[model samples]
Target: MKDLLGFGLRGRLREGYTAADFRADALAGLVVGIVALPLSMALATAVDAPPQHGIYT
Candidate 1:
């Protein structure tokens, strides 16, 4: 199982995350949110719904 999971499990068991890993995850989430912002608004408009509805989604 360890071999199958590979280097993702490289960290010490007691300290599972590093600061760099946290920063990278936060940046990735921010990017996805930015990209989704306009897309959600467009989708809502296409369906004749309020922009907030897509944002809620």
Candidate 2:
């Protein structure tokens, strides 16, 4: 029972993960970030600023 909840409070020192999981998550995040970047740049330009300024701000 303790093992099921990570050894009764101390918790598991190591957890499981896979390369495919990481790659998929990273790819999805990158796609969303890239999509947001263009819209942000357009908004910044409308406000009379450089595109990168939107990214920084």
Measured by lDDT, the strongest candidate is: 1
User: Model 1 residue 50 lDDT?
Assistant: 91
Candidate 1, residues 1-57, lDDT tens digits: the string is 564556655544336777888899899999999999999999999999998899989
- Evaluated against the true structure, the overall lDDT of model 1 is 0.84
> TM-score for model 2?
0.57
- Could you tell me which 10 consecutive residues in candidate 1 have the lowest summed lDDT? 5-14
RMSD per model, one decimal:
5.1, 6.3
Residue 52 CA displacement from its true place in model 2, Å:
3.0
**Model 1, total clashes:** 0
Model 2 alpha-carbon drift over 4 Å, by segment? 1-14
* Model 2 error, position 28 (Å): 1.1
Model 1's TM-score against the true structure: 0.66
Question: For residues 1-57, what per-residue lDDT tens digits would candidate 2 score against the true structure?
Answer: 446655443342345456777799899999999999998888899999988888876
